[model samples]
Target: MDHQLTQNLEEYSASSTTIKFDRPIPLLRAPSRPGLPMTLTGPYILAFKDLPSWAAAYKSCESKIIAQCEEGARIGCAITASNKCKPPWWQSLTGWKSMDLKERERCEDREMEDCLVSAKEKCMGFAKEHATTPFLDARIALGEGR
Candidate 1:
């Protein structure tokens, strides 16, 4: 059998739950600017050795970030579909069998970005307002600019 066919067969038999990514991708939202949103939804791997400091920072906030990313993906997917917007091509590529995969992924990525940006802003604002919470500080430490 051809490799693609074999891979497809393997995929079908595989447990979907077992195929987890290091990062649970957020859905991208459609662009209001009449084009694709910037960002893609895929398994984003962070090599601890490459950027240990950033990795540590992200680790500290992993739970929060993951939760937010998931929420963002949900919102983004819905909005993107409604707006009929797509995300950048560099993100995830859908198979030919799934005609809407491209657009859906695009939308999801956009939503995810939006959620991240919003979370960053909120954290920054709380940091400024409370001066003690450090919620924003934590996010900033993870490379989310204030």
Candidate 2:
């Protein structure tokens, strides 16, 4: 939604090729549900019109990761606070003990990293299958040579 993001998407789209696809490619979009954590949203996958759409989708995916991480931090803080006091037996039995603060944070970080990696892989794979030259050239122009 930011101007910079829009500009980046426009630049990437403009620099990328204009190859036509038999069918529109699916690209990932952020979850529509309010307060729905990205972790529960599963993998990054959706539909896109062109390189600009792809760039936008990719940015959305990154935003989702950040949201998930922040949510995890909030949950961790709540758990830590509860642990400081006396939590109910049911709460204690909920398996929160199995994952300490560090472990939980690490798990969330790992999940976010995995999601981003998956998105990058999917993007690259799609470009390779559809318009390798344009995609690569745009990446190079954006100083993201590969």
Candidate 3:
């Protein structure tokens, strides 16, 4: 057993409020197993103390969102099929004065801020709908450029 690895894992686990387990989480791994993926050779993470709660929370969060995520991902993929971040053709239209360009940029910034705020609020709303406690709230951090 790697004492350093166990100590590091313990240190990290201590910071999480949701999971509580024994001091030294018994780590187990087989060098090889039947039907195992070729890429999977790492130790299996096991924390039995509060597994039921964690599993239940994870399952609950996933159950309803399976279909929703699939559909949402499909729509999102379709919407961003051409993942180019280039400004719309209208933004590159005929020449304009500096003031006009600056004002347009300002308007665009405001619109982007508003959209980001609304998107985060909607994400939180969805989390709250399925979350019984703040600890159970699930969030996915999307890239700003995405």
Candidate 4:
């Protein structure tokens, strides 16, 4: 089956997580980005080794992800109990802020970078640990012809 869809993007910030790099990080010889399906159409590739590591990564980061999402949601909440909301991306943050949009974005980006410094190190550690494991590439051209 041939198909395609736009990738949804979101933004936010929090604490207790960091990933950084002093030099460029290669794609680890993977055909595509890690944990992402090869294409919009068919030809999905999943390696046995990757499955465990993928699950482990998510498991390791799941709580952190949820906590941050909840915090975002709370910030977006309408009530004074916004702290009671689920998360902004999930439910959307509706509160009004007095700061400039560009400045807010810059702040988010800076905070994100700060938190990811350690995360970058962690990813490098994983990539080094799995340096030997192969990541299969699956990409194809479609539509009219080649």
Candidate 5:
């Protein structure tokens, strides 16, 4: 295994919290098997942890939104379909400006739910820009992003 290659590739995370493959390039190819795609989609959970209670998490996330607003930061929330690369396996904390604390919480929950259902479909728009095949599964281990 190319340690450097793995490191470089692993470092290449995508925003919108999805992980996909780019046409099975030799270095980036995902596992090849019949049920591989399903396995790749994974039980990777989109976790939102830390910040203690929901209220606290809400507040922390809200603070980010407020800070962004004050700084005139752009709020961006997108699925993989809209992105230009093969959908990434991760997403940064984004798109907080257009929502209030409650809205953020709701959106978070909704996105999590969406991840459970048709993740590829939900993120299809961004996927076009980032053409890819099914590879590794993505689990959003929260608490780390904050």
Candidate 6:
């Protein structure tokens, strides 16, 4: 199969015009995630003796980060949506009325910002404790480091 694919690629590259092949060329599919496969590749087996443990830790961090971000988004959406409803009894009794549309939007924006900042802090704390070096390195590369 490898020989046949290489031959097909060579033939395709040599031809200037579109070349119709008798068989479809096979392509390599990337793993769903960016990390190495469950099994280590050649020459790296010694370095990854505990690959499963590392993978689990990486996945745990990933899940926690996703959950935190989702919660933040949920909180922001709830706040923005709640603004459309009437003020609570305590607030109404204290002369705090429901804000106008523009004011409500501003308030929502501020609340969302606060929620995201808190979420980020939580995620960073989790990463510090549970994430693998490579995972943290990647976050740093993406400008999300602590």
| Tens digit of per-residue lDDT, candidate 1, span 1-146 | 89999888877785843766687553222112212342233222222222455444444555455556556656664665545555445455653343377767777667666766776666545434543233222211223463
Candidate 4, 12-125: lDDT as tens digits: 222223456498754312333334534443444333334555555445454455455555544433232322222345333556444565765555655555545545455545
Rate residue 3 of model 3 by lDDT: 98
lDDT of each: 0.48, 0.50, 0.48, 0.42, 0.39, 0.55
Candidate achieving higher lDDT, 2 or 4: 2
Those runs of model 6 whose alpha carbons end farther than 4 Å from true positions after fitting are 1-86, 90-98, 132-146
Residues 62-111, model 3: lDDT tens digits: 55655465456445543443233334656556554233556555665565
Best by TM-score: 6
Distance from true location, Cα of 7 in model 2, Å: 61
Which 10-residue window in model 5 sums to the lowest lDDT? 131-140
- Our model 2 lands, by Cα RMSD against the true structure, at 20.5
TM-score of each: 0.25, 0.26, 0.28, 0.24, 0.18, 0.35
**Model 5 TM-score, 2 decimals:** 0.18
Candidate 5, residues 1-146: lDDT per residue as tens digits?
89999778766656434767668533212233334344534433222322243334444445554444433312232342223222233433453333355655666556545443454343433333232222112222345555
Q: How well is each residue in 67-104 modelled by candidate 2, as lDDT tens digits?
A: 55556555665555445444356866776653366765
Model 5 C-alpha lDDT versus the unseen true structure: 0.39
Tell me the deviation in Å of residue 48 in model 2. 6.8
Question: Model 3 scores what on Cα lDDT?
Answer: 0.48
TM-score of model 6 (CA atoms): 0.35
Candidate 2, clashing residue pairs? 26-46, 26-47, 27-46, 27-47, 28-46
